[model samples]
Target chain A: MLRDALLIAGKDLRLELRSRVALNQVLPFALLVLVLFAFALDPDRGLLARATPGLYWVAVLFSALLALQRSLSVESADGNRDALRLSGLDPAGIFLGKVLAVATQLAVLEVLLGVGVAVLYTTRITGWVLLAVTCVVATASIAAAGTLFGVVAAGLRVRETLLPLLLLPVLAPVLIGATRAFEAALAGSPSEGWPWVGLMGVFASLYIVAGVFGFGPLLEES
Target chain B: MTTEAHRQDIDSTGSNGTRVLGIAALIAMAALALFGLVLSPADANQGEVVRILYVHVPSATVAYIGCFLTTIGSAVYLWRRSRWWELVAYASAEIATVFTSIVLVTGMIWGRPTWGVYWVWDARLTSTAMLLLLLLGYLAVRRLPADHEVRTRRAAIVGLLLVPNVIIVRQSVQWWRTLHQKPTLLANGVGAKIEGLMLFSLFVGFIAIGLVFAWLLIHRFRLAWLEDQLDEAGLDVAIAERRAEGAAS
Candidate 1:
């Protein structure tokens, strides 16, 4: 399963490697959002610095939405879905592959956005250990949940609008968990971030398991 | 009667019998409103405005029940591939959404009189708002245009999501308690805090709302089942038309 997942993930990565849609469009969108957020909050004030964690996650979420849409759109075109089904690869492997590819893309995006917050919002990154752990867990949660809903929404005409509505409310807990953890790390209380990390871990596991079980049926539904 | 006949009879019997329950609910609401407004003494602390709890508590309870039903129906639908389960989930989610909306509106209206603010990021209220959003998502997925099977399968997945969300929303309230009161009703039940007439009024509110929910669920289930039959009939007609066209050619 892991080997099949890796093969699928490699294909997705190679596709993005060739296209760079995520790198050129989504990452810059994330950065631009950081700048816009700073402007909205008055860059000179310390308010932007304090709210950086929340704004940072919001940016990641929006860009993650874009990347998810793009990833599924790629599959929807040119009989790629039928091709996948015909290949006889495990559906759970495909799901895990999708999650891995999206998670990898998001991990890169989160790193760049983290730098953007540091640079634009002038908020220094302390508590690197806890901060990295929070980002890892949070990104996995978002990627797993996004891929599940993305495929669920991918086949419908209303998907463009429906994906965000369906995905966002469900991801609310992830947002809260990640933001709170980031806030703790930023406030120099890295010890306080553990419970929120646990929350994210649980949230991530729930979706990953759901994606594995539900994706095969969902993939066949359309 | 055969077992299948017996089951069908019970369903109809249950649904038809609830008509009386609906009228009973109507009477209960009137009495609830009256007793809550006049007979029940005002709180020494919260004043006459405390009357809203008679409505608000029941709204929250019914909404939670709706969520519970949706998740159960969703699970069964996925497992059994049953349209009955899908109909139940769809109807229950819509009812849950309405009840949750009432909870939000009533909570806000009641908050203004008591807390001096129309809204606060309190734990219970915040979680209730999240519940409403989750239900709205479920309803949106259901309303999306797709094949009956496609939509049902997708909506079932979305429906199953509410269980995890309910837990998270509640945990969030406890993890960061702000303005909202903690779980008060669970400790020794309603008999502990609310006495006599006030408790009686609250009980009436529950029966009224519970009966209304039952009434809505019955109608909605029937409507959804009819929709499925209509959809299949339409497909049959279209297929026949194609066949006739091919024969004419």
Candidate 2:
């Protein structure tokens, strides 16, 4: 199962590497959003401190949404989803592969956005280790949930609109916790902020298990 | 009776039953509305805003009923693979969304006058909004494509997964320090701070609104099922026409 999952993950990453659409589309959008935030605030350092966490997550979330929609949508639009299901691979493997790809794409976006925010806003990245840990925890949760929901929503014909609406609501808790944890870590608040990180870990596991269990039947339905 | 024949018989018998229910619900609603609005005395402390409880409590109860029905309907459909349960679940979810919306609005209206604000990030309000969103998501999933077998199956999964949301919504007050008031009547097999005619009026209002919700659910379910049937019929006609054209050629 692990080997099969890696193969599927490799296939997705290779396709993305060939097309370059996910990185090309998502990076520009993330960078533009970051620059827009910078200009909108007009180089205020204090405002940046307050807005940095929110701005960063918003960039990550919207960019992840863009990447996620593109990732699952290709199989759906080309009618290759059925073929994937019949390829003698486990559906859970497909879900795991897609989620890993989403997580990787989001991780790259986060690093870039973090650097942009630190440069443009004159903000310090205190507690680098904690910041990195929080990012991974939050990113894992968001990507897992997003991939799970993206697959579910992709089964429908009107997925482009419905996916975000359905995905956002279910993901609200993760967003709430992740944003808080990220903010706390960046501010160097304290170890007290770890609860929200714990919450993200729980959410990530729940979504991963749900995706593993549900994705097979869901693909058949599609 | 066999499954197909049984379903046909049920479908035929359901309309007359629904009409009788409609009339009965209408009368109950009218009577309760008058009693709760006109006949019930004002509370000594809360004044006219206390009257908002008439609508608010009933709407909350009906929303609960709607959510409960969705849970049951979703489960039955998933277990039995029967379309009837799916129709019922979809119908109940639609009605629940409207009532939950009303509950939020009425609560806000009552809040503005009593709490001196139109909105707060209170636990009750937030959780109720979450419940409303979940319901919308469920309905949207069902609506995006009208495939019964596939749609119903996915909807059932979503519905099952969403059960925890209902619990959280109900417990938001106990779990968090919410600005909104707690349940005034029957939190735990008993009423608090309300009794006599007010309590009776509230109970009657619950029953009346519940009946009205049932009436709406039945009507909406039949309409949705009919729409599916019509779509199927249209497909049949299109297929037959194509076969005829081929044969003529």
Candidate 3:
């Protein structure tokens, strides 16, 4: 399973490297959200700065939808899904591989968005450790959920319209927890953020286990 | 013969018992409204507006029952692949969404008269809102085109997934709300002192709502079965057309 996971991850990552979809498309979309949020909210009132963590997370959540869709859509074409099924790889491996690959892309998306907020929203990171850890944990949580839900929406004719509706509500806990954690961390009371991090970790692990155990039957459909 | 018997049991039209449940619900609601709205004494705090509690609380409890039923239906459908269980899950989710919406709207109405605001970030209210959204998503997934029984399998998985996720959403929302600078007005609105007719009224509300839920579930299940028949007929037509075209070609 681990070997297959690595192979799948490598293949997806190589696809991203060759195609540059994340760098070319989703990253800029995240930045555009930041820019748009700045326009919608008063930038000088200190409210935007205070709310930067949450707005950033929301942007990341929306962009993650696009990444998750691509994660599955890639396999939908050129007989790739059939090849996957016939390859005799464990479904759990394919599931994890997709999560890992999406997480990697989202990690980059978060960093770029992180820098954009610092510049555009005038947000300062007082507790770097808390912020860093929240980014990692929340990204994984989003990726796990996004990948699981992506498959749920994958084969449907209305997949593009369906994936966000199915996924966004489930990821609310992540958004709430991670946003709260970032708020606490940016407020310099890093202690207050740890519990939210724990919440994110719990959410992430639950979804990882869900994807592993739940993917068996789901994979056959695609 | 047993499979045929089971199929007949499920596929049969609505029964006389459904009428009984419907009548029981109306009677219970009339009793609850009388006692809660007129017979009960005014509260020292919020007065008559507090009577909304009877309907609102029952909406929440029965909604939770709907959630529980859906979770069970989702599990059994997954394990047994029974058409009955899938329909049960689908119907329960729709009923749950309706009751949950009632909880939100009625709570908002109660809030305005009492708290002078129509909304608050109270944990229970917020969580119910999330539950409603999740239920809508489940219903949306169920509406997707039927191919390979895919809708049932996927929706059952989502319904099952929702059970655990709701718990997590509840816990996280509760924790998140605590840090808010503004506290929810009437946070513990319903748990305050109550006795005599008010308490009994709540009981009547429960019976009323539970009966209504049963009535809705039965009719909704029959509707879903009818839908399944339509889908099967539609698929057969498409297949026959394809066969005719292929033969002509």
Q: Each candidate's lDDT (Cα)?
A: 0.84, 0.77, 0.86
Off by over 4 Å in 2: A41-45, A127-130, A155-157, B1-16, B165-192, B237-249
- Sorted on TM-score, highest at the top, how do the candidates line up? 3, 1, 2
lDDT tens digits by residue: candidate 1, B21-51? 7788788888887888989888766777778
Docking class of 2: acceptable
Q: What does candidate 2's lDDT look like per residue over B55-156, in tens digits?
A: 788898889788888888887886787788888888999999999999999888888876678877666677788889989989887776556666777777
Q: What is the interface RMSD of each candidate, in Å?
A: 1.3, 3.1, 1.5
Candidate DockQ scores, in order? 0.65, 0.38, 0.65
* lDDT of residue B151 for candidate 1: 81
- Which digits, one per residue and each the tens of the lDDT, describe model 1 over residues A77-166? 988888898888999999999999999999999988888878777787888888999999999999999999998888678888989988
In candidate 2, position B190 carries an lDDT of 22
For model 2, how does the per-residue alpha-carbon lDDT over A1-222 read when each residue is reduced to its tens digit?
A: 677778877887898899998778889899899888877885555676687877888888888889988888777766688789779888888888888888887888898888888887767777676677778888887888788778767756687887788777666666666666666777678474576677667767877887787777778773
Give the clashing pairs for model 1.
Answer: none
The DockQ assigned to candidate 2 is 0.38
Candidate 1 global TM-score: 0.92
| Native-structure RMSD, model 2 | 4.4
**On a 0 to 1 DockQ scale, where is model 1?**
0.65
Query: Comparing 1 and 2 by DockQ, which wins?
Result: 1
The lDDT leader among the candidates is 3
